[model samples]
Target: MLTKFSVTAAAEKFMRRVVRFSGLPSSAGFRLLVRTGGCSGYDAEFSAEVEARTGDETIEVHGLRIFLPAESRVLLDGLKIDFIETPDRSGFAFIKDDQRSVVAVSADVARIDVSAIGRG
Candidate 1:
């Protein structure tokens, strides 16, 4: 798969549902980013970006691709990305990476298998 880690059935299923409903093409990819906001000082956002690899960790969720910036990896440590497609709203969220307030970035993401971690 495109991701370094595996994904969960729930995550995979959700991804497909979103894509199917969005009617986007196969070449489309989901972009993950970290920005300042919320009470947590930073939050995550996902969209579509076709830029070059930037050496970041690219994970595959469901049949779609999730791109993480190379420098943003540590911030995403222990970060759990999830897709929530509700009747009113549909998008991805930063479920969890590291609950602890450390260096904003984390080393935890390095140990995770994007695909397998989702199932866990």
Candidate 2:
């Protein structure tokens, strides 16, 4: 169990939509691999997979199955996942309580600096 990880409502909805449209079976799960990178010390890549990979821990959150490898599980602990959208981009952001760091993951970009984001 991931006791310290939390997913915001927006993030949960986003994840559900991704799985629903992934063209995989209903039992498919979202596989998230996280590592240390980006400005916030969190870099993530995700995809819909038919099943959890070997050694992956499957977690059910609000009916959505998420697959996390060992590294991801540790990195995601104590972090909150949220979805953020702007006119120019939309993606998932991992945040901690102090809000000092954020890692953005999107289809078109690998990393984004949260400090540089502003209404334009």
Best by lDDT: 2
**Per-residue alpha-carbon lDDT of candidate 2 for residues 1-120, written as tens digits (9 for 90 to 100):** 554688889988877766777666778887778887765556677777789999899989977999999998988888888888888877778777667566445432334334323333
The lDDT per prediction is: 0.48, 0.74
Q: Write out the backbone clash pairs for model 2.
A: none
Q: Where is model 2 more than 4 Å wrong at Cα?
A: 1-3, 98-120
Model 1 TM-score is: 0.47
RMSD of 1: 10.7
